[model samples]
Target: MEILPGEGVALVKVGEHRDVVESRIGPPVHPGRSSRAVYETSPMLVLTYTGDETVELVELADGDGDGGEEVFFDGVQLTSRFMDDVVADLEAKGYEYEETDIGYRFEPGFAVFSMGSRWARDLDPDAAEDDPRRVVEGVSVAPYEYFAEPAEEEIEAYISSRQSGGNR
Candidate 1:
């Protein structure tokens, strides 16, 4: 599974049950907890899961030459095929995921299968917290062009807020 590129640490919504989580990034770096597991997919990317669903994705920018990870980007990417494989894997592993008119429901309003740019974008403040209608036709299953990097100001602000313990 190709982990798409961009940046951000998103909290993925998960089902109530705690059991297996299906991921191609491999076993988690931390798996002792029944509610969550964390995986460092690469030196730059970190993923977290609860039950069979992903709950968070954190992107670490390359070291500042002093060998420190820098938090950056409010954007991240996951391909359509990747979403399908995750659902298929969940089903194969005996997990159930609910699909609705909006998209595959993830924590009520969010979705594991929806459309957007490779880069993450802010939700409209006026939109409902869990609106699946954000996407055209309520679902997305196509590839998108890779994202160009976000502005330095955006990156810096995101990093600063993250370091100050703000949640995105």
Candidate 2:
């Protein structure tokens, strides 16, 4: 699968209906709630739909290493590359990003989450250099605005809803 950052992943562009996705990729192995589906692709594919039943987000996550499908961005293989190396490449390419607790959120609607490498105290010090936990655990693509800070009104609405038990 090819991740096109803010656009989409491979042939599954955002804004496509669920029916179109099912027709293109066949049925999902795990049909989730009304808004989500999971395909058992090499690295597992997850599609999230909006209330209108249109694709809103595309995510690829690590699966059992049976090694069938490979996810790529630019020319780099995302599922197998180490997070440090990936970040270095991103820097070289001049992409602006914010470092999160788990991984990185690039400004171009791309976010990567890393495995629990930092908490793996039992790992060998030498092997830590190539630790599997350093690889990306999952990656998601959405609209550029998805990464933007929420508007004050949106935040206030959320707080008010929570206070009133409307979000509970």
Best by lDDT: 2
- Estimate the TM-score of every prediction: 0.23, 0.79
Please list the C-alpha lDDT of all candidates, in the order they appear.
0.35, 0.75
- Tens digits of lDDT, candidate 2, 67-107: 65667777766655567777788878887888877788888
Q: Worst lDDT window (10 residues) for model 1?
A: 137-146
By summed lDDT, the worst window of 10 consecutive residues in model 2 runs over: 117-126
lDDT accuracy of residue 41 in candidate 2: 65
The C-alpha local distance difference test score for the whole of candidate 1 amounts to 0.35
Q: Which portions of model 2 show Cα errors greater than 4 Å?
A: 31-33, 63-65, 115-133, 149-153, 165-168
Q: Write the per-residue lDDT of candidate 1 for residues 1-168, one digit (tens) a residue.
A: 222222233321222122333333455566565344445533333334434553433222222223433322112222222345445554565544466543353321223434443211232346555544332111211112112235899899989988889654
Where does candidate 2 clash, by residue pair?
none
